[model samples]
Target: MSKQPLAPSVADLAPDDSILTPYDYEHLGTYLNLLTADAEVTDWREVSRVVLRIDPAQDPQRAWQAYSSHLARAMWMSKLGHRHLLGDIPSLH
Candidate 1:
């Protein structure tokens, strides 16, 4: 079987597209990690540093934005985005 894509050290602000995008598919693991971190009551700044490779101490705004947006997208995926993943809707690109 093919290997799953590895989570990236850095990620762009998560997409706001109505449908799932290629970026979402590639960052699936990252999204899940974000969800887990939230569930575990992990601090957002710490999550940013560890998971996204962003230093909140150096760039508080950037780190917060990245963590916030990514976590929101992760929740979206858990709610409604999986329907897109399960369907054969073409052109995630």
Candidate 2:
């Protein structure tokens, strides 16, 4: 069976504004560029869009959790060669 895609809630989709202060946007831009450098790589288009929409007042913990969730999903896809089993975001360290 094909796995379902993750449909985050509006609140979960919101980006954390605090990231702007603690990190350089240019650095993120670089990372994003690197992630999309190879044409063979399936770019995280939706993840990038949602991350760019983070609210400045969003909680740091929540923002971190969301990022980590994205990373975890990507890792799972890489290992399994299949989409993730969409569900609740897992807690990360």
Candidate 3:
């Protein structure tokens, strides 16, 4: 079996496209992690440090922007962006 692709490096802001982009595909794991963290009510600073690799202590604003934007993108992926993925499958029709 082929290995799963590793998540790409976290961006300062996730793409805000109406549909998922190649970057979104690469960051699927990251999005899931962010969603999990949100569900668990994890602290933003900690999530930023661990998942996003942004040091909230050194740059609070940047870290927050990155974390929030990424988390929002994650939510979008679950709510709407996933539909776009279905188009990738070869239809029997």
lDDT to native, each model? 0.86, 0.36, 0.88
Off by over 4 Å in 3: 1-5, 89-93
Q: What tens digits encode model 3's per-residue C-alpha lDDT throughout 1-93?
A: 555456567888899999777788878889999999999999999999998889999999999999999999999999998898877633322
lDDT of 2 by residue, 7-89 (tens): 32323322333222212222334234323432345334434345433333455555555444445433334344132223423
Q: On lDDT, who's better, 2 or 3?
A: 3
Give the better candidate number (2 or 3) by TM-score. 3
Which is the leading candidate under lDDT? 3
TM accuracy, model 2: 0.33
What C-alpha RMSD separates each model from the true structure? Answer: 3.3, 13.3, 4.4
| lDDT at position 77, candidate 1 | 93
> Which lDDT tens digits does candidate 1 get at residues 26-82?
788889999999999999999999988899999999999999999999999999998
What are the runs in model 2 whose C-alpha is more than 4 Å off?
Answer: 1-52, 81-93
Task: Please provide TM-scores, in order, for all candidate models, with all chains considered together.
Answer: 0.85, 0.33, 0.85
lDDT of candidate model 2 versus the reference = 0.36
